[model samples]
Target: MQYSPDSDPSYDLKIHAGFKVVRDYSFSFDKVEISFKDMVRFIFPSTGYLIFNLFFGDDFTLRFLNYDLSEDLPHHLYITGLLSRGMLITGQQGTGGGYAMKIHPVIGYHFLRIPMYQLTDRQVRLSHIFDREGRPLRQLEANASARTLNDPGVKGFFSKYLPDKSVYLRDPVYHAVNKIISKKGIIQVKKLATECCMSERTLHRQFLLKVGLSPQSYAKIWQLHFTMELLKNNPGAKLQGIAFKAGYYDVAHLARDFREKLFVPPSQFYRDVNPMMQSYLDFPDSLQ
Candidate 1:
């Protein structure tokens, strides 16, 4: 599951009692959904990409981007910027069929050309930034509903939007980010700055510019991510063992970190929902 810059993610399909998560890497698409459940809340961490959601049904009302409970965004395509952390709560889910595309971190900046740090933990209409004309995801969503679009069509859609790689795309900061992700956020921030031959302040600036989070913040989130992965894959593993393996000093240390980041203990966090979907969608093994 090692991912090079060009590597597409591996896929996995998970079937819950009522909802199914199609973890397809076919079009750089992370997950597809056709929900039959009433409500599901998704807790997602930073994935360094702007997420495109081509929502097809009107039954589900998702409250994110600080939308009020009365707001209903139906039959529209939504775009979420690089999130530091966020929650998606679906109200009255019946048929929320959709396609999700993970826009490359660099390409997001290239297209928007704005400070990504400002976009952290927010959502906007994709049409608002790129506009409705020549909207690829909207077209794909239509075709998908009609059973006219295949995997190749999805691939072609993204190929059209791939950004030209500038020096920043291949810079040391980019490499350092990948290295930290590869090690499951276990690597030291000081070591990463040294390897990139930049001062710690410079490293932080680059990360905020490119990935919308400081390296320290991303690393902490990734540690929680790794812990979740371990829990999902090895349900029988002891809490103490999982914590230590995920780079926490002990179970208490892990608990405190989880409380600060997730606002819940690990056990309570995993009790209500399937962690697998979030894990696969957010921190796929290829990127890890």
Candidate 2:
């Protein structure tokens, strides 16, 4: 399904935030395009999904825990690994647009053909991965626009890289991921290991290899992800209520996670950021 800001119930919130947003959830991977009328800064929360981002019209900077990364490539395409902590992104002033595809970590590992642990909390230029002469890179560049998700060029590029169905069926890590999602990140690691029919040590090793983060770390990120969703969807909801709904023990625990992972307090974050941008960081349920 495609969602436009105009047709969405949050249309007024998006317009007031100076954003034009489009989302397509029809495919296994979620695709989104967002345009900003002015310069903006926001905290994009940690997620289990590996993200591919294409930038146009302006450059952006990403600040992780200890270092800063910027996009300066001619094609302006980059793939972000599964983020373990929130990142602060700042876009330059003037009209700017970006397209992103959110991929499952298991599928991302198969597509990249490398140990996913090396990519944790990092971003790599797409040019380094794909030859400049390749059709995937060329098509992605040509279709990096407002209609990116629906464009034939983008779809054609992705078609060549889709993983096989057996990959999901045969991977224990993938099944664990589905269990984590279904529980909304509230389950214990020992229980998860038991349910997946693997020892805790084995589960940890496999999760790091396939998902770029350990099971505990991934669960924490997913918990924060769920909390963010609650905050975005319920603008007026109290912190205590939202925290409980997201499976936190209390509001203080939720606040601590925000400060630890996002580098900001919950109150300040909600007050300073745009709701539409917060929604953009959400991991879609369909992808699970």
- Which structure among the candidates has the greatest TM-score? 2
lDDT of 1 by residue, 1-288 (tens): 111112232322332222212233223444345454444444544454567655556564455434223333554555566655434333324565555566555456665666677667766665455555337656654554322124444445445554555634666766786787689889888889999999899998988897788888777766777887787678888998999899988999999877766667877666654443454355322211
My TM-score estimates for the predictions, one after another, are 0.70, 0.73
Candidate 1 whole-model C-alpha lDDT, 0 to 1: 0.58
Ten contiguous residues with the weakest lDDT in model 2: 10-19
Report lDDT per candidate.
Answer: 0.58, 0.63
**Residue 219 accuracy (lDDT) in model 2:** 85
RMSD of each: 8.7, 7.1
Model 2: residue 260 alpha-carbon error in angstroms = 1.1
Candidate 1 residue spans exceeding 4 A from truth: 1-26, 30-49, 58-60, 65-75, 85-88, 92-94, 131-157, 165-169, 275-288
